[model samples]
Target: MATKRNVSSTKEEGPVIDEAIERNWEIPDFTIKEIRDAIPAHCFRRDTFRSFTYVFHDVAIILALGYAATYIDHLPSAPLRLALWSFYWIAQGVVGTGVWVIGHECGHQAFSPSKAINNGVGMVLHSLLLVPYHSWRFSHSRHHKATGHMTKDQVFVPHTRKALGLPAREVDPEGDGPHSALEESPIAMLYNMVMMFVFGWPLYLFTNVTGQDYPGWASHFNPYCDIFDSNQVSEVYQSVAGLLATIGLLTYCGQVFGSLAMIKFYVIPYLFVNFWLVLITYLQHTDPTLPHYRENVWNFQRGAALTIDRSYGFILDYFHHHISDTHVAHHFFSTMPHYHAEEATVHIKKALGKHYKFDPTPIPQALIKSWKTCRFVEDEGDVVFFKN
Candidate 1:
């Protein structure tokens, strides 16, 4: 409801680097030299394609899982069928995380050496899940650039008391306040769901509702928008084509397996796939402790700089790198592939120290902790960056 503008000046903010560790934060000339040394030494550089081996393997695994699901009736007992169904849903969610990563790579222009390839790959993967690739890529890149900044940061930034105004009711940022209003009201929930990704992608394509208010070519699914600043309509076409192809496949699967069987094997897994997507993305940005900037205090750097790195530990290491686990590093150096993120976090932590925060306890504890202590509005005056 507040129509404030961003008025914070970079001059008032002082230097970009913290003075105490500014000298130490340097890539250490030796390390920079060492990092540069490997550029040409390795057969693949950042832009170079790494054989597409993972893509093939991932696709093959998905296919194999699909096949297994299709034949779940072949299982000898009820328990086996139940086990297979459980495996299918969880595996789909996990694999779907990879799929989102590939789309994210498209956002970074890292999925393949060519923009053409990245767009093609990104659109297909994202579209199959009903996301609009260009819409997300545009805002997402801005999110990376402005991770922890108080005001301009995208996704979920914690709101300060001044931002909320003294008269406003204090409520949970993730649930009662923003969420309840968004969910319980059709219009509000429509906006929330759209902004939050349930229906955000397509609406971005068709409406350009929640993202940065780029006036000109922003809403259309066309290539004119700045987000499409990376790829072309060919990528959009691929997404459409993927839908068509999937429709054909679904039709065939249904005909051969019958609607109920297909529902058990395919539709259920497909629906469940995005549930984790919603949950992962929701928890990543929406902690009550996280800050969202009011327009005046919101600066690009401050908003973007605010994020918490979550520890999903071994599961994230073995699989979901693109999820919330390595999120802090991802926010800082987004162009780096998820594959390189875990390694980079070590260097980053040594440099960032307290600036880097990790919720080491199981997410369940974090969730409950967040619900209780994180309630209500934090004063911008008192909000502490992990460094303090």
Candidate 2:
């Protein structure tokens, strides 16, 4: 069992830690049943028609955008054409991510009560987005089951102090050990952010970057990868088949439409979809105020509470289906559909009280802040917060 240190004694004995970092990081006393009870029963009901409506709504916008792009080249002014194409990329990327979110809902069986319907829709949508649907769905289930568990959570698992080569607590009790010069440099940070937004998703899918370490190969594409069970190998292969089919389709489209047209119509906006996916997930789980627990201190209720809710403003929130704003509720009740998440969130806040974390910082500022501050956690604590 992991042991907890007295917070007051630690402050007095070592160098002063930031007061803001000194939060109530103890394990929550509440039960998961209590949280479930807090939410209204109706919020748990799934509406298949309403779910399909959103899927249709997003697909219609994407089709309209594609149709609008056909006229961009005919515009008399080059500058106007360029500006509109850029607008189309950004707009389509945003809506594309909303489609991705719906697929995610389907993976969680929140889109409908019928598992087959959910999987069928989720498989097609995610496969179109180049995601291996069943592979990600299975691994993502593990992520939720063990969110904020230091050794167990699947993605965005923070590096430990020792893993990063930071000095031991006894050697640098103040935790003032300097980070590598390159890591602290602003230019390096910018470069890293660009690389992350552009390539992070592919790297994660191919190499399991930012995910838990496993023996031998660990990839979303590998049916035998450690992230899945023996029984799930067939499903993993199905995901792979779906991904291959999508790739074949895209290859055909690129040849038929010409590569530049394909790039303009698909690739650039697809990159933006990757950008939004990384940004939203990174900010949701990575914050200095959030705590990750060692096995002895970890529980589903506590892990779920560690998630942070942030507003991406009204417009983005609507398009993205409130994924950013109501994440805490989603973590607690993964089966709850997005349309009803906001209603459930109100009750979740009351149930969790001080334990529920919400950050109101504008997303751009919050992204920078988390990237700079949430580097790694201490090696020894039962409950540890990220340290710069």
Candidate 3:
């Protein structure tokens, strides 16, 4: 819990996001207490009216998409039907999931002024999509609060080299490790493109593959009630409702589109959603150059600031409400609504200047690059690369 870090840099590694101390500057104790503890003023300048409008509009779109799926799907001709199917599946899956992230903001209570509103909105949308709203909210907030405190961090803790004859690496993906296997994937290379996009979220919460450990009281799998536990009744009930809704959707599609057409409708677009979701989450973090801290040296500011941002296209950007674009701001001020995120981010960058990290590469290329570069490399024994 060191509070102060030397802000000077003379090394030539080209602005990587490592939490390690650099050699040229003296590494000071960088506790959270030292890092401009004031929440930025920009955080308060939320255009709540506009954000509410956007949220309202996004909710409309979700209903509209579902309506489209349910009724007046497409023209009956084979080619025309195929075209409509292609448009909806591809558009809805990738783009639809983007709105879901906003719903995720609701879970974070970052979308609105009221916790009831946030939870209500999050509950509806997330439960509709099979996400256990309260479960994710509680867990995700823990991730933010304890971002890099090794002893108390929720997810993504780096494993030390000496621990398993490896440098500080990502913690184990299997049982008894940092997070569950479903949370992070060994196959993260094409993760968003296919593997995780389709199966990642399902496996993680349901199976607890790479998820955080809880005492028996908090298990997500159990349907029993417990306050302050992530795996609890609300999660179970909401998850059941979401899953049942999905089944109902499939059943409806089977009746209308026929078994084969329903299969096409259900699977294809869903693939796009999973792919993009996985990809977005992946590139936002998970760089080999980014260092994870150990118990003594970890700090939240350093951990949250270690994110990398890249530009996605305009169409996707509008659909997702720049959540991808505004994630840096989100990390810094988790309570800011999505609409205000862009404005807040602009100000934050101005203040941060070079302290900010950005990756100018396009998403496709970065995905390819990260695939090759970011595979399970552990922490280094020597702290020189991470020197202060």
Candidate 4:
């Protein structure tokens, strides 16, 4: 593993940079075992029954919501009916996201002790959400293994300055640097956010958008895509089949019960589910204060600590299974159940000290700030910070 060097003077190879930037960006010296040792042993245990209970709970709420939504057509006023249907979409979407979270837990093998149970449940839930389960699961494991690696990290890899056509760092000052006005404009920011939250998930699935660049065509649905190994092709094909089955089911429902009804109940809510999925993940990894490391400075422990945990409030946190607030713990120990993550996180914070990152900024504000400022990273640093 490489260690941080204290450079006080400007070197011929690079520009003069701030000492504080280098100081703050030093690679952590603590080992992963030290952090794991801080958490109680029981926190690592997965309860099969407890995990199934959450699955049932989410499913029950989804069915009840679907049943309750049946009455919207009976409302006397069109405006009233539309309002109620809108509410159902947002409410069901939130609950549906909870289901997605559970599926995600299954992908991480944190839902149950048995791999059979975890994969079986995960396939069903993820297929319902139109996700390729095994494909995402395999790639997500890679993400956990290399969370902040500039090239190896699976998702939300920052654009390097060279990629964005920005000038060399030596040409610009350390603190005051050139920023693209149009890219940072309010209108541009809003447009980018809308595109990201609305279509980001689908784009990522189909085209590997916002993911590490791979040779040739890359897609979650493509078994032969560079994202998966030859040995994993069978599982990727299984995920594709599951998605096809779900699509066929949805199509049958559309034929049986008018396309408009299907749109109102399923399609809209599904989009919102995608929105929440993208929002949660984007905010977790992308932040101004967070550092992305070149291969030399990157290691599993440092890469894992690159993530930030943010509070989405009690309601969102609960329904979302605390994926946002307890993310640091999740990265450190991917197999730890979500039920015990909050407890694990408390001990992790103590163990990590200043290396632990938790951003308490309200979700909306944090979303905007990250979008505006975290446009790209310098192409030439061992440890790089995002720059506008």
lDDT of each: 0.55, 0.89, 0.58, 0.88
Writing each residue's lDDT as its tens digit, candidate 3 over 1-388 gives 2222323222332322233443232323343333334345556543546656766776676557656865434556777766766766776675567667867888777766777777777777776565677766766787776654444555443433344443233443331233333434546434554655577656656654334444454444456523235445555566567667767877887987699765555566666766676678767766555544444444567656666666787788778777687777788678777666677677666655665667878877776666554434233221212110
Q: What is the lDDT of residue 233 in candidate 4?
A: 97
| Winner on TM-score (1 vs 2) | 2
Q: Considering only N, C-alpha and C atoms within 3 Å, which residue pairs clash in candidate 2?
A: none
312-363 per-residue lDDT for model 1 (tens digits): 6676545555457666666655666666666666665665555556666577
Ranking the candidates on TM-score from highest down gives: 2, 4, 3, 1
Q: Model 2, 1-388: lDDT tens per residue?
A: 2223533223324422233246745457899999999999999999999999999999999999999999999999999998999999999999999999999999999999999999999999999999899999999999999999989999999998788877876576556444666776889989999999999999999899999989878999888879999999999999999999998999999989999998999999999999999999999999988878766567888899989999998989999999999999999999999999999999999999988889999888898888888888877656778877
TM-score of each: 0.67, 0.94, 0.72, 0.93
Q: Write the per-residue lDDT of candidate 4 for residues 315-365, one digit (tens) a residue.
A: 889998999999999999999999999999999999999989999898889
Candidate 1 TM-score versus the reference? 0.67
Higher-TM-score candidate among 1 and 3? 3
Give lDDT: candidate 1, residue 159: 42
lDDT for 357 (candidate 2): 88
lDDT of 1 at 129: 62
Candidate 3's C-alpha runs over 4 A off are 1-49, 59-81, 148-193, 212-219, 223-267, 377-388
